[model samples]
Target: MNTTQLDYTDITEIRGPLMVVRGVDGVGWDEFCRIDTGDGQLRHGLVLEVDGDLAVIQVLEGTTDVVAEKVAIRFDGAPLRIPVGDGWLGRVCNGRGEPLDGGPPVYGREMSSVAGWPLNPVLREPPSQPVLTGVSVIDGLTTLVRGQKLPIFSVAGLPHLELATQIAAQATAGGEPFSVVFAGMGLTHADAAFVRDALDDRSAAGELALLINTAGDPVIERILTPRLALTIAEHLAFTQGRHVLVVAADMTSYCEAVREVSAARGEVPARHAYPGYLYSDLAGLYERCGRIRGRPGSVTILPLLTMPAGDITHPVPDLTGYITEGQIVLSPQVHARGVYPPVDPLSSLSRLMRRGAGPGRTRDDHLDVAAQLLGALARARQARELAELIGAGALGPVDQAYLHFEDRFGRDFVSQRPTEAHTLDQTLERAWQTLSSLPRRELTMIPDRLLDAYYRSDHG
Candidate 1:
C-alpha cells in the first residue's frame, strides 16, 4: 500500500498498448497511472508488472502517437475503484465505468475495488432458490438457480447474444428484489444497440445496469468490462440486499484480449497462445458469484461465449466447462430448424437445478417431467439416426412413435417467440403437452399418481 505518487519521464520502449518505464521506484502492481502526452492529451493506464527498477504499464486508451521522452507518467499508487450504489441502475456505462447513457456521473458515497474483494469459502452458502428465465425450455428443464454460474455455449452464427439479452430482460426472482448487470465485450455497434433496445424497459424500471465495450473501443477495455459489471453487482446484491444476475456475453472476445495482452508482455503461451493461467483467470471472474452465508442477497453469473469453428474442444469452451457449474448448449442444427432458443436439451445441463427445483421450490412434477422429456428426446435421436440409415418405413412402431414425439416436442415445447414470456406453470403445461404424444407405457420416469393428475390422454 504505497501512498506516494511517482512521476517519470524515462520510457524504455513502446509496443502496441504496452510501454516500459525505467528508473521507477516503489511502484506497485495494478497501480493506476496517468500519461500526459506532452501535447496536452492525457490517457490512463495500469501497472501490469514491476521488475526491479523497471515497470510495465498498459495504456488503457492505447498508444498510437506516444513520444517516450516527451510523455509524463504518474503512478497513482492504488488500484482502480468505482462508485457503487443504487445510482448505477438504469444507467449505461462503458468498460471503464464511465457513463455512456448521457446521464450524470455516479457520485455515490461508497467506492469498491474493480478487482473485487475475495469471499471466504467457509462462508459460501449453496444455491437453493430458483431464478426463472421465462423461456419454457430453460425454466422447464435446466432451471437456473440463485448464486449459480452457468455458461451458454454456442457456435459461430448462433443467436446466443439474443438469448442472453432475452434472459436478462425477462428473468425474475419470484417477486423478490432483483436486478441484472449486463456486460458485452467486443460487441459491434449494432449488437450494442440491440442489447440496449432489448433491455430498455428493464432499464426504465431501474432493474438493469448495462456496461458495453464495443469492438471499436480500446482492446484493453474488453478485459475490464466484466470486472466493472461484477463490482456493481456485488454492491447491489450484498450491500443492497437484491438478488443480482450478471450476464457477460461474447467471453471469447475477452479471452482473446487476454491472449493478446499476454503476447504483448513477451510471456510464454500455452494452448492456442493463451496464457497458462487461463483457468485461474476465468475462475477469478466466475468465482466472484454465489451467496455468502449471512448475506441477504446473492450474485449469479451467466456467461455466453462462441465456440470457434464449432469445436467444443477449443481451449476457451473446454476450460470454461471445467470452471462453471454447467452449460446451456445452443445447436446449429436446432437453429436451422427455425427454433427461437434452439437449446439442445441433451447437450445442456444445470448441476444445481435439483437444489432450485422440485416439490417446494418450482413444482413437484418438475424434476420428473424433465427426466421423462430427456429420456424421450434421447430415444427420438436414436430413432432419427436409425431411420436415416434405413428408410422410415423400416422402423418399428415404437421407433415411429419416438420420431413423432421428437417432432411435436421441438415444435411445441422447445420453440418460443423471442418476445413471449412464460411462467413456471405454463412451462410445465407445455412440457406435459409434448410428453402426452408418447404412450403411457414410455413414461416410466414419472410417478403413476402424478402422471394421472397432469397427463392428458386426449392431448396426444
Candidate 2:
C-alpha cells in the first residue's frame, strides 16, 4: 500500500526512449513512474537520473505517440518490482514480466525488485556440486559447477542457440529439485518460437520459465529480459528452495541495447563505444548467482554471448571473461564439420571444474580421463598440422594413429544428436572408447590403475 504519489507535467524534452521532466522535486533515482498518453494508454517508466529539478525517465514502453503537452507523470517513489512466486514456472512472459502464454496473471504474496540485492561474499558457500549439462564436451571436459557463472562464447551463424536449448532441456543437478529460467534477448520471432518449442516438454512439466524479448520488441526491454528472468530465478532459489539454472542467450544483444541507451543518454563511451560502466553492470547481473551458506538451493548461470566478427577480444566477451568464472568457446570450424555443440575444448575452460569433478563426485577416474583426452587431442591436433605440411603418407605410425584419434574424438565423442543426453558415466565411457584407438603409452595423463581398468588397445 504505497500511496506516495508525486505528480509532474513539466515535460521539457522527449528523446528516443528517454523523457525529461523538469520542475520536479522529491523524485528519487530508479523511482517507478506512470505516464498517461491522454488516449487511454498508460505507460510505465523508471527515473534514470535526478539532476536538481530535472528528472530523466526511461519510458519502459517506448514513447511512440506520447504528446508532450498532454502527457502526465506520476512517480511511485520506488524502484521497479515484479511479483514473485512459484506460479511463474511453465509460463511464457515478455521482458516486462507481462504474461504471453494467454494465462492469468501470476499470483504472488510478495513483490521483488527486478534489480536484485547482492549476495554477501562472506555468506557464499564454495560451489562444489557438478551441474551436468548432458553434452559430452561440457560434462566430460569443462564441467559446469553449481552456482558458477559460465558463459558460452559463440560467433554469428553458429549453433550456439541450439546447444543452449539442448542444455536447458537436459541439464540436471543430481537428485535436487531442478528448474530452468530461460531469457532470450533480442531474438528473432523464429528463434523465440524455436526456444519455446525446444523447451516445450520441460515447460509442460512445470520446470521451465521463459522470458523472451524479440528484435521487434522495444530495445529498452532487451535490457530488462535477463533481469526479470534472474529476479524470478533468485526468488525460486532463495525463497522456494529449488536449484535454479538461468540460461540467458545472446547477451550481445543486451549489451548492444545498453550501448543504444548509453548513446541516448549522452554518456561517455568506453571501448567500442560501449559505456564505461559495462563491466560493473555485467558484474551486477553475474555475481547474483551462488550458493548461500545454510541454504539448500543454488542458482547457476550459463550466459551465452556471441563474439562480434569471431573476435573474442571484443569488449563484450572480453569484459564477460573478467566477470564470469570461465567460458565455453564454440568453434566455427567444428560446426562446419557437422559437430554438434562444436565446443573447442582447447579454447574453453571451467575454473570450478576441479572442485566439482573427480573422486566421489563424478567418477574416481574422472579427472584423469579428462586430462588424458585433452592430452591425446593436443597430440592429434599437432599431428594433423604436421600431416598438412608433410602429407599424410609421410607421417610416422604414432602421428598417423593420432590423426585417426582426432577424427574419432570429433565424430564420436563431440558429436551427438540434439535429443541425445549422455550421463557422466556414459560420457566417460565414450571417452575411453575413443582413447582406445591410440597407443596405451600415449595416455600419460591418466593413472596406470585407471588405464589397466578401462583401457583396451586396438593392437591386441
Candidate with top lDDT is: 1
RMSD of each: 1.1, 1.2
Per-model TM values vs. the true structure: 0.98, 0.98
- Model 2 C-alpha RMSD vs. true structure (Å) is 1.2
Error of 2 at 296 (Å): 1.0
Tens digits of per-residue lDDT, candidate 2, 354-385, equal: 98999878999899988888988998899899
Model 1 per-residue lDDT tens digits across residues 1-460: 5456667999999998899999888888988889998999999998999999999999999998889989989888788888999899999999988899998987788988798855678999999889999999998889999999999999889889999999999999999999999999999999999999999999999999999999998889999899989999999999999999999998999999999999999999999999999999898999999999998899999999999998999999999999888899999999999988999999999999999999999999999999999999999999999999998999998899899999989999989988789999999999999988888888999999999999986435
Model 2: which residue pairs collide? none
Candidate 1 — which residues are off by over 4 angstroms?
A: none
- Give the poorly placed runs of model 2, Cα more than 4 Å off: 1-3
Measured on C-alpha atoms, candidate 2 has an lDDT of: 0.91
